[model samples]
Target: MLQSDRAEAAEAAAVIETQCPFCSVQCKMTVTEGGKGIPGQRRAEYKVEGVPNAASEGRVCVKGMHAHQHAVHSQRLTHPFIRSNGELVPCSWDEAFAVARQHLQGISEQHGPDANAVYGGGSLTNETAYLLGKFARVALGTRYIDYNGRFCMSAAASAGSKTFGIDRGLTFRLADIPLARCIVLAGTNIAECQPTLLPYFNQAKENGAKIIVIDPRKTATAAMADMHLPIRPGTDTILADAMLKIIMDEGFIDETFIQARTNGYDELSVYLNSLDLSQAADICGLELEQIREAALAYGEADTGMVLTARGVEQQTDGHLAVRHFLNLVLATGKIGREGCGYGAITGQGNGQGGREHGQKADQLPGYRSIESEKDRAYVASVWGVEAATLPGKGVSAYEMMELIHQGVIKSLFVMGSNPIVSNPNAGLVEEGLNKLDFLMVADMFMSETARMADLVLPVTSYMENEGTLTNLEGRVLLREAGRQAPGEARHDWMILCSMADMLGKGHYFRFHEPEEIFNELRLASKGGIADYYGISYDRLRREKGVYWPCPSPEEAGVGLLFQQSFAHPDGKALFSIMEGDPWKGVSEEYPLILTNGRVLSHYLTGVQTRRSPSLLARELENFVEIHPITAQRYRIRDGEWVEAQSEHGCFTVRARIKDQIREDTLFVPMHWGGVQNVNHATRPDLDPFCKMPGFKTSAVRIRPLHQKVYRENDSYTER
Candidate 1:
């Protein structure tokens, strides 16, 4: 309001361009680095505004605008900590590194190299993920390396690889949303989980695109759809199969595309002909007419798209569900055309790129399978190591926890992940962590998992560090930082390099910056499926972002995949037949289906999001969402405490009785921790194909708080 105030504000302002760290949309924005805090908000600093980007066209959500507050929170870890007699205390970095080296080497020497393990997270940068995988293989000489992405994206990744021979989150760009004539969403709450993406869907609807939604809960996304099929949990494949059969019976099949561009259709057609629409409808708790309408709408469209998320992927038969959906797109000639394709919306900000570089137990950089001798040799050459020295595939994420409980894995090095709140059946994960001979965690704050660690290393958050992230569209963008990390907090790669030096592998891990590590990544990824040999930091800055498979400088990047042919050697996509009973396995003793998901207020595990004062004020804690009929059956009142018990564990929380969810199902948010953490009651039954845990369809029973059993039995099965 005054001239002096305007002069002082202009004197201290410096702008920087960056992106959000919450989800896969990766909305870009500009921040005033030295600006004052919001006019009315406390502890929230820096002024933010959305900038135009391909993924998010000049729009930012509440999480993106205030994401920087957590980076400057007072509770951040400023110094490395080493556990004393019974508690963790601040210590010097050298002392902490020395203790870590001593214990890691001792464990490896006594029980062999397989005893040492490394666990990473999906939000880690490409360079950090690549180096972490190398540290596990060369520095610790261990094979136990995996990440949290296995819990979030592995099911869709497996199915995409099996069908299309490549696994990118989206085959095309986000700008093509308005060009589609029909769209189908299965088991995903896009409105709450990815609010910034709602604009594109809104534009599509305005442009005359028919939308179909399949979910047990009448989510906000479902409310906006033209048709909502209130299907039962764990029965997605049955509904998908029924649609496939309807498309065929109604003569919507593209004969030319089936003959020229696909395989195994004869077998798929045989099964589709045998599928009964009425029987499938009864099994899935849906009317036959809803299924027929959705199928015919998609079949008659000139250009169509199908997208899915954890609702279909966090099941025991998750891979089968993705396969069936991809089959629907391919059989009707919906793919490889402008505005027609299939994509799985990635939950984490870097889930797409994290899996491409490494950090998975069975994969190498560039999406190469570590099991292949040639692939191993090529990557080994890039690392200046012999192929024979590399370790083979170890195990999946949840299985690694099982090994920890079995005592096969004596020590673990965790980075950027909090399995205590993110993993399924987290009670068992906590018990296994307690059994570790030595446990180390690197995080920006004292996460739930960090509280149980023998050593805790301070690391920088994305808002305080510079790196690269591949968003859901497979666009590799150079992310910038607006402020320096507080205290002695350092980058994860820097901490890892120090550890590698202490382990006597300094030559291979000699890198002072992210670009040096990224250069090495380019060489290792040269000929692999996710080739990035030609992409450089300078190129990223000039072009904004480049898609993967940019094998040469002149080629730039390829956003549209398979315009001519599929990535398979034969240049054709493949379809597989699925046969089995589609059931959530609910019994009379545990007759209700429990589903886990995210809310609009918080993110996965709530490590950083909860620290933000404004984000926490909206949803202070988690609650059990129950239908009116189910609440009446259990004699539970609104706002009354209720206990939900499963074979895995039990959690008691306040009940919010509503009619939005199905009568046979219960919905719980996945952002909280402690006694009310929903993961405590989620099943860990993994899919046979991708090993993704069944977080969607757990058999559970509920009762009023006072009427609960006095003695709760604990059944910890290593599933």
Candidate 2:
């Protein structure tokens, strides 16, 4: 049980009570109370601990363990702040809201409604995201808003939409992974990103599943795989296409399922006629033998699933790549079956929930399209807003930033995103932020992007708020308020309501509690394709978190979807033809390719985990991971201070040599910021389909720094 009062704790104890809401593993904890454990208080468990719940399983990583400390860190914004003389100063909420109204209204008054852009993060609660979407379309009178999910799961969702006529993934649950006999993973790093699911992978291994890993990096998960294919970056679609060709040529496809359930087979067949195994193998940097081996292994397995992550979906050709991957699953009749399907592992904890609840610019709740008349009318009827007034689609995250830099977007209201630290092409986002006539940011901490804001509003941490969060597997769980909010910090939803009220659009946000907002979203979802018509707050609370498609009282909602028929108009899964392409940044001048990712110790941007004493004490500072050969070539020593510079920008940090990385590429964790922000030197190029910047690849040079290395004395060399 948590203490009733936070006031009695020491300064250090109060700092670690916040929750880390970034990834699918929502870690719950209590901060250490008061002073760094005095002699009398040494026995107290001041460190944040994981809640013993079904969702968390009484386990947590470094990021989740120290999440609470971030809320009270030095960078936390305690009050409403307004920019004065190019400096941010603490101000009253009234003053902040006044500035907001003035700037936003002025932008609309002068340049028209289209000039304002609203950007939300996937990290936001379902309630906050839902209201933000409403505000963008109704109050702001603009359709230009998209969350970071655009960069994370758009391609996968779009691929599912094309195949199923609906944009959801598994009808199956995360628990089903352990039951699989074959798990075909393409371009995803699930083992590192979603550590909680690792045991399931091991379970599959124990069940005699042949795990096939296709990726550029030989990750820990890949190393554990029965087979790992080190394909060239950006060439995933090619491999997928080759597998389809083999499946069709060998007659492994379910002809009955194809004829009875799908559309567009002739077009796909004609498209695949041109590519050969040798061509695909050559382009993808894999041998034909390896491809054939992987294909046969996957096809022969009793049960299988093709799981992907940001790696396959973060490239310019991401959509096409996913489409091809889905093609293989459809051709083999692997989908809609137990322990076999096409699934994308979401990075953020609530990304699935946020998107389902209508955080996207082009979508309404229940995965309904905003552009469709029926959907718009049905949702409008439920939301009690005029269907005609609800605007159409808007630009995505990368596009918005481009528009901002191009001067098409003059003002931006950012919620729960640290684009300055998280987005690729950090320089471009910085330029865009500096150019904004008015920038409003709502967050608990004054993050890198928030620092550039014209107005910053202090918001409550997850532990201080009440709402529901849906995990990657579509399990919606309640978030109970366990601690008191600091200073004037308030819930993010409340702040939006106050802003809406000031703007004379209070009706758009009539709810007083997040639960009320969720009820309205559910109402808006009625009669839609991704319908949760039978779902209510009551059902959710009663069952932990129910999966979507919960439209019947008897339906527990299948975890592995598409077991009977696909959501396609023809009720069948369709295949797409794809070809391989090399990484866009491959060049002679910048010989080595660089990639970015996260470690078990940190989450995105390091804004939260870095602030926690428990987690930070584990890692002193930011460092780059590189292959020993590459490091030696640059005259770099292990644990040596160095500067990594790219064409876009540069940063200095210590380098750690590890053989896990490929000699031709370098790996950097995405969690670092301040003096060692990785995005500073990252390029702005985005995947053509999803518009997600190529965070995995960059061209960079490394040189040893004469300065002292931070971890020179640490004994990381031994276990």
Candidate 3:
């Protein structure tokens, strides 16, 4: 039998504590339990106690305080369930395993393996991610497997690897930000998203450092900045070219460093000289004076750093924007330093781990390209498979959705992702999922997408499982199970392994323990950017969290990467010749430009956060923020309902008057589902290079709802 509720009280009263596993700050937290519940009931409630930590300083946000609520919510699925007569019903573990295996095998035999795809999320642990990747590549023989990281960090990773030969996984140490004289926060709302990093920004401010913000809207972070340039969307590359032109004309570049550490600078200089500030100002929709101030401020700072996030990376020009940012840093001699560098703030907690474990279509463990014979042979030998039989790169998320709708792909296994609510052109994505011959969804909750699944396998939540998470800071921390599974639900790793064994791939999935899987992953990661062969659970416990590249047993973990030299072949970061066109979708018929992002009260798609009363109380419906002038032009009043229509679909929401927004633009948080799904209106046109859709901007129209003298269908009586 499981331990009694008294155990929670005793454990909380103990001296030891753990950290919140959500974000990178890794705030230390002490656990406590509420007094006994109704006398006859055996349930106990857990509470969070503060611990002295760098980020929280013995404090936590509302999300951290209510994390336990997420674990034990009534909506949680506590039993193995299978679809029967178009409705999911609880079933035995053996029955669930048999149904999943039989369907997957039947689909693979009838249609090629390429007809099926798997999607993973960054929330899974390294051990779980390792097993998932192996199951897709080694067992199913399908290359059509990708993770949610492709939508978040792949562009940044691609640019970094192309320039530095290694990706920077939150390697910028907190101890160094205070030394920098200037900090450029571009396209990131760090103040609200990662509250833990605010201290470093505050420390930099105290040290007399200049702060510059580049974004389309004047966000909270921008409001406090010394200078904020509201550059037009999709025009970052043009601005980069203008900056390079000014740098070359004013002789501000580090010639010695360029000559000694870089290549292609001369060619880039010529390409940039072809473009000037006047033309760039027109293309970027920024005044000449504002552009000059931002460029000169950055060029003149004693030490400079550039920090970016999803706002910059989720667009169609994401890769070019990243490469351009690298160019600016390298030209200014900021690549290798204490407080000055280029960093991409990751979104998901384990985004770094997800990409590292071979969940990407074209990559293997250690980030070796699957198309390269040498890399393939190395990984094949490690996994005990023949290199020749390994499939090549596969379709991305957008492509997969389109193919599924076109009847080219017949089956899919979705793990921990809700693309129906999160993907662009979500209406089409939903249609594609509905049309699939077979659909399997494995998650803790019956999410919007899971409700349409042909099979739903109940999986354990974070609190009920023991695993590891790699945060935005590149620190890897261990997770201890805080609660037992409520019913028959199992960990995702165990479920995947069980299915693999039932499908006759038992040898490759023979691990009885998660640590054994981790050991194999460490072996596969040898001699790569992240070396973990010498790392063990005991060693991780000895330290708070270990950064990668601790390849040797005697070596301590790395805090700052590329301190002396870059990983690039030339020992310097490479810069792309940035060039781009202007925003092309807006028109007289569709005068307003629509932008999408997060609100502090809610998370992505609100699949879990919305269910919490505390979070839901803050916001239960969607609202669009429009400039006061624009709202007046549309004759819309605050708290009044409005129709927001795009080319693909339309959603109705309340209109809010805010002077912070640009006059000709609209700001809508993309967390709502059912009646107010924002992704329904987002276009699917992708960045040519990275394949990321242009979700940031689109043509939109807003109009006030027609008022009626009397309500048509009144459910409430007037008092």
- Candidate number achieving the greatest TM-score relative to the actual structure: 1
lDDT of 1 by residue, 61-145 (tens): 9988888778778899999999999899999999999999999999999999999999999889999999999999988889999
The TM-score-based order of candidates, best leading, equals 1, 3, 2
lDDT of 2 by residue, 442-525 (tens): 888777888888999998887788777767766666676767888888898898888888888987788788888877866777
Query: Please, what is the TM-score per model?
Result: 0.97, 0.90, 0.93
The models' CA-based lDDT, in order, is: 0.90, 0.76, 0.77
Per residue, candidate 3 scores C-alpha lDDT tens digits across 280-375 of 898778887887777777787778788878777777888888788778888887656788877888777678877887877877876777788988
Ranking by lDDT: 1, 3, 2
Candidate 3 minimal-lDDT segment of 10 residues: 8-17
For candidate 2, the 10 contiguous residues with the lowest summed lDDT are 1-10
What TM-score should be assigned to candidate 2? 0.90
Candidate 1: list runs displaced more than 4 Å.
1-6, 35-44, 708-719
Candidate number with the higher TM-score (1 or 2)? 1
**lDDT of candidate 3 at residue 324, scale 0 to 100:** 83
Clashing pairs in 3: none
**Model 3 per-residue lDDT at 365:** 78
RMSD of each: 3.0, 5.4, 3.9
